[model samples]
Target chain A: MSELLKNTIRFILFILVQVFILFKMPPLHRFITPYLYYLFILWLPFSLSRAGLTVVGFIFGLSLDYFSKTPGLHAAACTLIAYVRPFVIGLLISQEGADKNYISPSIVSMGWAPYATYVIVLTFLHHTWLVLLEWMSFGSFLYFLGKVIASTAVSLLLVLLTELLFFRKQKFRTNTI
Target chain B: MRNVFLFIRRHFNFLFFLVLQIVSLSFLFRYNKFHEAAFMNVSTELTGRINEKYNGIEYYFQLKRTNESLVKENIRLRQLLKENYEAPDSNRRLVMDTIRVDSARSILKYNYLEAKVVGNTTALQFNYLTIHRGFAQQVRPNMGVVGPQGIVGTVVNVSENYATVMSLLHRQYKVVVKLKNGAERGAIEWDGLSPLFVTLKDIPKSAKVAKGDTVLTSQTSSLFPANIMVGTVYDIVPDNASNFYTLKVRPATNFFNIEYVYVIDNMQFEEQKRIEDSTRKKVQ
Candidate 1:
């Protein structure tokens, strides 16, 4: 199948699974919900490029916001992650994200620590903006701050766990190396 | 210009992704529209159905506690009914034949509509309780909500089949409560902490307030039926810094662990509400 078709299908499946099933599951309420929806955007193809990745992340976030009904909160947060993802990866992995080609972005290419950091930082940024938008005022600053931190931590753990459990990316030998 | 076009062509896929994302984000933020309003608002039909189905299972599990509470409430209601009149049990039972008949009919009247709790947030800084009752259920804003113990809070927002209740735990919750003996009225507000201790605000320094005194909802609240047991005066300390007496009221109803509640619909709530509202308008 074409990559676009595959990605589109994945997007629908992820959102359906998220909205209809996962979002409604109360047992997963603790440490899972807010982060569970990010898997689709995270699973975008390796060759998506910086601008592509950023844009995809933004749309993915907006979709969540659209579903979660908090207005632009998710979109804003998702955009922040998209914008920062490339730079954070570049800084941590010492790999030129601009030049590298891969089928999937994963620990096999980026290394465990760097990939984890990338996910954690972006997820945190996304959650912070999203939660701040939910509150919409500084009057409940303490409450919003707590939610941002707690939700980010939970989201990071979920993403990391999913990565560990379901995925093992196909890696390039890079014969010259 | 050729270079720009070449650059754009080179980054077309990424640009497509970026543009789509930006457009989606703007659609959300700029318009501030909630496409997923239903997910957050499982407050009515959705959550109500789910709760009803699960309530059967939950009911089975909570059989012991539920029965115990039912028995306890029955006893309390019996005692209240006995205290109110000198008549025999059968006559009172006939009067209270309807489920809608309230025990507080001497000084107050009520209409009870059964509502299931749809969504409740306890740990949040300003927690709110949402129920499967609203305009369709004939629930209006400012109507009093009471658990078995006493007053829980007041209805604030109403949708078609759902409404949000500002729990007594909320920071926004403020009602004038008066000590039964002293008749000293003060504003009661949650300290944004313990749901139990509703702080008595704006009391004069000289009010002879004491711990263990009966604290009840004052006439100041048009929303609530008068003399509802708000709490018992738990502690009395003079605010020397400010010319007010602060009392820590241990609410009659333990709100922290509350499960079932009754929404008190006073027959004259609107009449009193309009009078208070119009008078305030004239004064302002």
Candidate 2:
């Protein structure tokens, strides 16, 4: 299947699972709520423009908001993370990987540590902004601070678990004579 | 002017982010109220259909539990039937051979509309439930919904064939409840920490309250009928700042596993509201 088709399928599946399953997870902790749908944005091929990334993020988050009943909280968070994606990718990937034509961000392509950092940063950014906006007008700063940290940790774990289950190492072409 | 345009061209990404953020935040704030828009609710046609399809596959797994609750409710209802009790000897002397409608009849104030739980969420500070019944099924906003165990929520939005309920787990969701057979009244609100427990606020210090005592819906609320089981008091703490005790409640209905619910149609709700509104207007 084409990369476009594959990513499109991934997008739909993530939205479905996020809305129908993960959203309904019985709260294990008061502050922790798992959110792994942002994996679609994290896994996008590295070549997309910054503008494209932000737009996609908005649409993706809005789609979830449509069903989850939170109008724009997810969308704004996703857009912010998407806006910062390129810089994070540049910071993590080596020069050689940057020069490559199509690098799908994953454990195989970006190595485990860099990929993990990428997911962590993006997930943290997404959850922090999401919780802040969701609890807008609340007086308890410490409580929301705890919420941001706890939700980020839970989401990070979910992202890593998905990586373990689904991501396979891609064969990178070595430099030849 | 040239420098300004150059700066704008240089930082276009930031500009894009700002625009999108404004758009989304507008949506976030605009429809935050209860009945503003249908687009964000699960009651909308497309989302409702999708949720229904998903719930169809998930419903079977919950059949045993649902059946058990139904059977228990049936037994309870059967015991309340007039035929189950014999007339007293003193009353029997005054009783006529003709069947008395008022004496024999068990008046049912709230009619139940059985609905399948299609979509639900409990992880957020504000959570909602989407059920299969809606405007088409006479399920309207403010209708009380109860699971097999206890009170669930009130319907907040309705489409042609689906309704969205402001779940008991939501931070903004509140229900008036009182201790069973006790005069102490309080309101139940989720603490947003655990799904298992909600905090019951406003019970006065003088009111008798104890652990494991049953909490029930108060008659003051128009949404739920009086005396429906809400939960049992798990713990009670006296608030130093106020003259009330905050009782920790273990909700009777397991919100996470809710599969089916019955929406209540209060027959006298409209008349009751009309009278109440008129009274309020006169006072104002």
Candidate 3:
């Protein structure tokens, strides 16, 4: 499939699954809410400019916020991740990997460890900001801490699970070091 | 001017991020409460129609449960028939009639409009329930929504045919409520912890609150009528800051099972708010 068509389908599918199916699932305990919707931004092709990435992230978050009814919380969270995503990607990947065009930031494109780090860093940032904004004011320090930790773990797990299920396997090569 | 232009070009990405954040945060803060305008919510025609479509599919799954609740409510209403009560003395009836006539012929201060729950969320930090009734059906923002068992939420935004309710499960949601046995009112708030529980704050230490004591929406509430079922006290502890009790309340409405609810409109809300606003203006 064409890259544009594939991503467009993925975007709509991600939104539908997130808002309708995952949101309907009962909370894991009282703290964890599994949010995999932002993976749409994470999986965007690496060639997209930073400005374009931020704009797309903002729109993606805003659309989710429209359904979730938290107003700007998701938008702000997504934009923050989008802003930091390139730096995280650069920090994790080797210089050669950075130079080559990455089709998508999946396990196959960037080796498993780097892709995992990229997902972890961005997902954690997104969830922490999201929880902080949701709370708005500091009512209970312990409760907020617990929610941030638990939600991030759940969301990160969901992102990795999606990567495992959907992405193709990396081809094995002879040792050459 | 050249230096300024160069600076803008250098930090364009950061500037874009800042601008987008500012715009979004403004939206977040602007429509926090009840408003007539249809901004980003389930109330807009496009979103509402989509949600209604989803609700139509989900409705069948809840059919048996919804029917059971409706049947229970019917039985309760049936038991309230005037014939079930002993005939009051004629003198007392005459006095009641006189009182009613003096107070514009009735004491009922609110009207209830039945609405169907189209889309709802209980797991989110700031949960909202979308209902079928909206401005076109006289369902204005700030009206109270109550399930068959207890208070649900207040309408925060509205479009022509749909409205969005900030459910009791929301972190920012607050309502005035009191014990059934004592009139001392306290505020109810959720901690975003559990869908089944909420905290009642500002109850005086002197009040005789006990486990299982019924908590009800207070008379001071402008959105809902007095004495609507809210919750029951499950636990109580004194606030460290003051001589106030914080009661853990188990909300009566099972938010997970809510399907049908009644939207309550206060007849005198506008008049009361107008007069109150004038008093505040004079004070200022």
Each candidate's interface RMSD: 7.5, 1.8, 1.8
lDDT of 3 by residue, B172-284 (tens): 79999988997899999997777879999988888898999999998798888888899899987656778899888999998887899999989889889999999999999
Give fnat of each prediction, in order.
0.21, 0.83, 0.67
lDDT score, residue B254, model 2? 83
Error of 3 at A10 (Å): 1.8
Give candidate 2 regions above 4 Å deviation.
A96-100, A168-177, B1-11, B35-38, B41-43, B91-109
Candidate 2 structure, TM-score to reference: 0.89
* Candidate 1 lDDT over residue span A126-158, tens digit each: 777666655673356777777678777776777
iRMSD, model 2, in Å: 1.8
lDDT tens readout by residue for model 2, B38-141: 35544265788998898888888878887888898899889998678776678435544565556644455688899988888887877888898878789988
Write down the TM-score of every candidate: 0.64, 0.89, 0.90
Clashing pairs in 1: A52-B14, A67-B36
| lDDT for predicted candidate 1 compared with the true structure | 0.65
Give chain B TM-scores in order: 0.70, 0.87, 0.88
Best by DockQ: 2
Find the 10 residues in a row with the least total lDDT in model 1 chain B. Answer: B31-40
For model 3, residues A1-177, the per-residue Cα lDDT tens digits are 766797888887887788888887877687788889999998887778999999989988887778877667788999999988888888888546542444667776677788788888888899888888777664677777888899888888788788768865434333422
